[model samples]
Target: MTDIAPASPRHQKNMYMRQNKVLKDKVESLELEVLHYKEQIDKLTLGDVPQIVKNWMNEYSLPWEIFWCFEHEKWIAELDNLFPYHMENCRCDKCES
Candidate 1:
């Protein structure tokens, strides 16, 4: 016969509490990181940018145009063919003359 010593109820509760605390800490840390990333994205889209830069981007083209530019090289190449002159003239806010 095997002698098995089960954990006491108090010990099991303590272990569960400790595991819960660790999980909570990790979740809080991940939430903080997500908040920081959201702040960075907000800065990119709406804050931190100068008015002149915003004006330049507004003049350049649609949001999808820029999104597609970075999203896929193949799309850019196709766009380059369809709008060769416009593509040549297109510039991001930072690259605007």
Candidate 2:
């Protein structure tokens, strides 16, 4: 094995810049992916089967009873997260209507 010399200051700065650019690019790509997912989630309406949930059910191929129980639990958790802290005081027109 050969010993390597440390990078010079200019070389180190160049390496750092390349790394920063790569990281920034990766973050931008991930942000776009999250936005895509959010758009897909937003398209869901009442009684609609979300693609992910449908895939999960098809992949597992669970009995209807088991699937519904798990589905209900998942909905409960989602509902808990979706509600505002002051549910009764929500100002949205949809909530009022």
Candidate 3:
């Protein structure tokens, strides 16, 4: 096999610069794609309550649960308003009304 001459430093640097540019561009594009997917996930979860919050709600009783609902009312409504199934057997004065 014939030996090839090494590339000149200027040519090597130019090639390296081009490769660096390509890698940078690829990274930027991937970052944008990640941001896009994150936005999509956020949109899909916009009105969703986290499972941890659900579990926390399940761990409490009437007034405390109502307090939790009131405290988080900015992101959620009263517990009964959102989860009528659990409220079906509730005897709170607010629910009785």
Candidate 4:
């Protein structure tokens, strides 16, 4: 069997540099995507969001927290849909449904 030669130091460095650049570019792209998503979330929270979400936003100071709740706890949005009329008029601490 033929002996295999290891890569030279310079070749290894260039490969590492190329990998680093690729990783940096990926990170930058991900950061931009995150920023875009954050902007969209901000727009939704500040602009034409659902009234239930708006009410929850008023109740809780943090908009993202409320949005997160709606995302993870789908029952909240479902409950809101179930009782839209009651939710509109009522302003109690706990919703019956």
Query: How high is each candidate's TM-score?
Result: 0.47, 0.47, 0.47, 0.50
- Cα error, candidate 2, residue 20 (Å): 0.6
Superposed model 4: Cα runs more than 4 Å off: 51-97
- State residue 26's C-alpha deviation in candidate 1, in Å: 0.4
Residues 1-97 of candidate 3: C-alpha lDDT, one tens digit per residue:
9999999999999999999999999999999999976765575367575565565457753222333233223322234543544654433334434
Across residues 1-97, which tens digit of lDDT does each residue of candidate 1 receive? 9999999999999999999999999999999999976765654566354454345457655543342233221122223333434665444433332
lDDT of 4 by residue, 42-89 (tens): 755575556766676676554434343332322234334434344443
Better by lDDT, candidate 4 or 1:
4
Question: Which consecutive 10 residues in model 4 have the weakest lDDT in total?
Answer: 66-75
Clashes of 3: 0
- What is candidate 1's CA lDDT for residue 19? 100
Give the clash count for each candidate: 0, 0, 0, 0
Best by lDDT: 4
Which pairs clash inside model 2? none
TM-score of model 4 vs. true structure: 0.50
Model 2 ranges off by over 4 Å: 1-3, 50-97
Task: Give lDDT per model, in order.
Answer: 0.55, 0.50, 0.57, 0.58
Q: What is the lDDT of residue 91 in candidate 2?
A: 29
